[model samples]
Target: MESSLVLEKYAEKNRFYREITEKILSGKTLNFEEALRLYQEGDFYFLGTLANVVKENLHQKRYYYTINRHINYTNVCTTNCKFCGYHKKPGEKGGYTYQVEEIIETLKSTPELKEVHIVGGVNPELPYEYYVELIRKVRENFPSLRIRAFTCVEIDWLSKISKKPVEEVLTELKQAGLNSLPGGGAEVFSERLHKELYPKKIGYQRWLEIAKTAHRLGIPTNATLLFGHLETDEEIINHLLTLREAQEETKGFYCFIPLAFIPEGNELSYLPGPSALKILKTIAISRIILSNFPHIKAYWVFLGVKLAQIALLWGADHFHGTVIEEKISQSMRKDTVVHLSKEEIERLIQEIGGEPVEI
Candidate 1:
């Protein structure tokens, strides 16, 4: 089979991507080449149309969102990742750690917020107990508020510092008021990409281990993948497969968030960000690939209001809600909005022909 002929035969047989589109529509997974071609060929307009069929089939016009606040406990990290612009230097003026009392005070200040997402750079001065104490105090302050804090990297850090297994650290954290783990720091699971792009970050296995442990401990978790950096098509699929396999094992992932790499003052300033079309394709692929997980979330923070509104047609069942304070974006994101108001989210969904969910 000649190379061009093989590719041509696929296009001819599919004939307007009917076969591939149906494969996705029928709830089947698309491989590396198929997923990449969706991005490479400039055909997302049609792809988004097809993906909406799945979205409507699975989720009609209903959209899911939450009232959440993202708090950065500390910005000091041991791993000075290359693509990070938010981490302060060791002697940097703004580098400071929040005590449990300070964090409780911050939580007390916000009355409407029910969920708190606490994650930041890996801190050296604060040991695992600091996190435990923080979670306990936050819970003590607001017993009803759900704490969606910590990342896989932080889990691995706790494992090392406390000299305990990952499961033990997670158990301790959970007992102290940790509700669940947020899906961050999952840039790309490709080892080659990981070594090249973020050498200071945790390894792929460590991340999987932490999520798996959290699931075993009966903690619900959210997973994410960062595209548009230095990952190949096969690498992207591999990242998805890693996530899918973990979900299959634990059945704990609540949402699959496909976050775009917003290149601003980011360390990877030279890298081009994913286009609107690519972002849509990624959302569609996430919906098609992550069959184990029930929800596919479209994070409006990095994608901005316009693209996120359009993404509803691309199998995005959940429109991520207003993040009261999002430093993660300003750290490396280009499209940084403090908080997309409820009114803004509602209008966007209405524009997309989807209804905003009250929850």
Candidate 2:
């Protein structure tokens, strides 16, 4: 694809192809759709160059890494959203909630880990006090560890259950040592497509509102798009815009994670998997459009190692976690070993010529 094709395709978009080609040759920001088009049409040379330039520019060939552990505080979710593989039904054998002692025991043992990523089901029965006390106790016990916990969905559910304003709950959590919010459950942010995938769950706009509220209240949060699962190009653009608008308003979104939908033992079983090209295009486009956020992550667990490595050049700056016990999404795909050890994670980041930086 020539420079003109991208410019013509994204005429009104602030960062068009002509500007992108000029920037590429002169070394500036990338053109979003041109990169998307490259992913669509397989422009290897262009994609490779983009990755190398962006990666080197970001870190100068140095990859930073951190050791972290994943602890599912609980798994009993009432909003058993179809796309999720983690939620446990009432009578299901695996339905269990973590006692305060269990989570404390797990945290105390892992002294080497610097971060704790906590996310689980939207179980209304799990009292709001469980979360508040958990954060307070964890912070009091391990003052050094950064607690990157909770999804926007969890915050929404918790607030509604507690009958308190969103800001007040977040304020209490922050005081108790809540660090950041994860970008999970953003499964494709289109009104039409979201209804098909997660009709029973909270609205997509509610997710954005909570995320925005978190950022404004001094909490940094990551956002994601679960693409390649019955969504169209128009849907993708719309999703990006919603996130972009939030970024513009709060300037607190830390990264944009383009998640590849896993289709094993799930509702969308017959859907074909997304190709590497499609994945890379989405990543590049995310980086280009969500220009306000600093990092565009290429998550290894969801996309697999090979694609994540290749995506380093396509405007992706971060390769998300060094999860010791990542099991939720892994349950969806029988063959995937969801938990990636720190060393294994470093190997992949180093292989791609990108440094994994610690928070």
TM-score for each predicted model, relative to the true structure = 0.90, 0.87
- Candidate 2 clashes: the total is 7
Highest TM-score against the true fold, candidate: 1
Model 2 steric clash pairs: 51-313, 63-355, 63-356, 64-355, 64-356, 64-357, 65-356
Candidate 1 structure quality by residue, lDDT tens digits, 214-300: 998988889889888777777777788778878878899988899888777767888888888778888877776776677888888
lDDT of each: 0.78, 0.75
For model 1, the run of ten residues with the poorest summed lDDT: 1-10
lDDT of 2 by residue, 173-225 (tens): 99999999988877777778767778767778888888888988899999989
**TM-score of predicted model 2?**
0.87
